[model samples]
Target: MLSRTADHLFWMSRYMERAENLARLMDVTYQMSLVPQSEEKANQSWNAIITLNSLEDAFAAKYPVVNGENVLKFMVCDSDNFSSIYSCLRLARENAHAVRGTLTTEMWETINYTWLEARGRSFDQLMAGGIADYFEWVKTRSHLSRGVTVGTLLQDEAYHFIRLGTLLERADNTARILDVKYHGLDHGGEEGATDFYQWGALLRSVSAFEVYRKAYRDVITPERVAELLILRGDMPRSLLFCMNGVVKNLDLVANSLSGETARLAGLLRAQLRYGRIDDILEHGLHEWLTDFMDRIYLIGDGISRDFLVPMVEAA
Candidate 1:
């Protein structure tokens, strides 16, 4: 495959996954913001929002207050915010446009129509008790596009690259989602009644609330929540599940020159697969999450160096 085509496929899928992740994260943020918070917890929660998106300076410049409404605007509706859902969909559509011939008609239509429909959105309208609905729509649209891609596209290198992007993006997101609460809650103390709600909210943000119940069959606890989100393979949004998919796809896409890509994927998968939640906690959840995200970056870079860059050099 051409380097340009591979790049487009990889990035298009990444953008889609990013958009979905932002929507879901925003949903959780909104829900969490409504609850009573300690001064310390409130500050930590608001800071996590800025840090998670890596937009602290920009957000501070735009809004002096880091309240729920302002954070929602920065995350959802700010066109200048490159990581916003609007920009993600725009970039996804643009990348898809460059490789229109490479995508199945259904795949193209799903994303293209999503981008087009998003054009008519009024941010003000959505803020009036409909933002949650808007976030759900974004998630639904992304799921539709991915389902179409899986069902309609040929299972070739293009599909493999797409899968690589999706899983890597998802792995990064799951890690960040898990870490968002690391500082927001006091983990060393007995589980307070409030801790139960906070922990349950964290699980629900990733759509893991019911799955958490099904897996543990006990009341929610920080340790169990971490274990369920981090190590459980059956949890679709779990870090290990996403990493497992990334490794599988990278293996399928591997070539003689692509050893580094597959190796990194395998290494990370092994680390997560054999990892215990207790180990992660002992190491510090923030540190563990930071390491996971950094490794994901290395794996993505390796893919570009091995497969994507070689084509560029040849051309």
Candidate 2:
């Protein structure tokens, strides 16, 4: 396959997945913000959100305060923020359009319509119980795109690359969300019913609440939640599950000159599969997750080198 086409196919899926995650995060944050808490505590939800998305400085420079409305604007619709939902959908559509020949008609239409719908959503609309609706729309549309691709596309290199991008992006988002929530609670230590609900809400944001219940059958706690999101293989959004997909898909995508990417994925997969959440916590979860994210970035570099379009140096 041509590197340019591969790049477009891979990134289009990734940006779609990223947009869904951002919506999920924003929905959970907005919901938590509405809970009856002290003024100071309600603001913590927005603060944690900024930190989670790594938008503290950029967000502060654009907005004077860390409130629900401003953060939602910066995350969901800010034209300047490339990681925002609007930008993700716009960029995703542009990429998908570039590879329109490679995609099914259903796949193309779903992405196009999603982007068009997203552009019409205003900040006020999202804030007034509209964010939740938009969240459902983003997730449903992304899932539809994936389903169409799976049902229509051929089993070839293009399909494998799409899987690679989707799983890799998902793994990073799941890990980062868990890391941010864990650290936020550790520092804030607002224990009680409110804290319990916040913890469960984090699980629900990733669509993991039921998985947590089935796996543990106990009340929600930070440590058990970490276990569910990090190590449980059956939890579809768990780090291990997503990394396993990367390993399996990369193996199929590997060619004579490009086995390195598969090897890296396999190594990461093994580490997580054989590893334990208790061990990670004892060693400091933040340190462990930081290392994991660094390794993920390296694997992303490997993927680009192996398959994506390369940049040429100026003479």
Candidate 3:
């Protein structure tokens, strides 16, 4: 396959995964905002919202008024915002369109239909039936597309690349969400009421509310939620699960390239395998999460260098 084709497939999956994550993150943010904020909670949530997506500068420039509506619109629907949910989905469809023949019929159909649905949504209409409903719709479409891609796509090199991109994106976003929760609760002293509600929102946002409830069968706590999201390998969006999936796909790709991508995969796998939950917690969650995200980006760059970029393209 041409490197260009592989690159497009990789990015196509990354963008879809990113869109789903953004929608879910926003859902959690919206719910958190609904709970009455103490001065600390307000400031923490505001800062968390800005830093979690690295949108501090963008948020300042786009919205002179830093309120919820402005933030939500900018993050979710602003066409000018490159990392917005709408923009990610648009790019996903465009990338998929570029290498149409490489994808399964169902993959193409799913993305094309998603694009068609998004194209019809005007800003006013999207914000019409409450932002919650709109977020839900986007999340549903994203989940459906992933299902279609996995169920119908062939298990070829293209499939592995797609899985690689999706898993990488998932690992990064999962880390980010955990960062938001960790930082917001790190100075935990006074905001007990808001903290509990925020904890519930965090669980629900990842669609792990029911699973977490079934497992714990008690009140939501910061430590328990962190354990569920980070250490639980069975949870689809857990850091362990995403890292494991990436290792599997990268192993296949490394075999294809005769071990070119092996070091990158090996490094990440070792970090997760050897490190314990206490290590992550005791070392300060924010710094640990920041380092994890940096490593994920390095892995992605290595993948691009070894697999996506052709000699001519590099030239």
Top TM-score model? 2
TM-score of each: 0.93, 0.93, 0.92
lDDT of 2: 0.84
**Candidate 1 lDDT, tens digit per residue, 216-273?**
8999988898888888888888888998888888878777887877877888889888
Ranking by lDDT: 2, 1, 3
For all candidates in order, the CA lDDT equals 0.84, 0.84, 0.81
Estimate, for each residue in 1-315, the C-alpha lDDT of model 2 and write its tens digit.
Answer: 988898998899899999988888787777777667777766776787688667788887899998777877888899899889999999999999999999989889999999998898777776685678888888888889889989999979999889988998898888877876776566656788888888888888998888788888999988898888888888888889999888888888776757877788888899899998789999998888888888888898888887787644101
Better of 1 and 2 by TM-score: 2
Over all chains combined, what TM-score does candidate 2 have? 0.93
- The residue pairs that clash in candidate 3, if any, are none
lDDT of 3: 0.81
Clashing pairs in 2: none
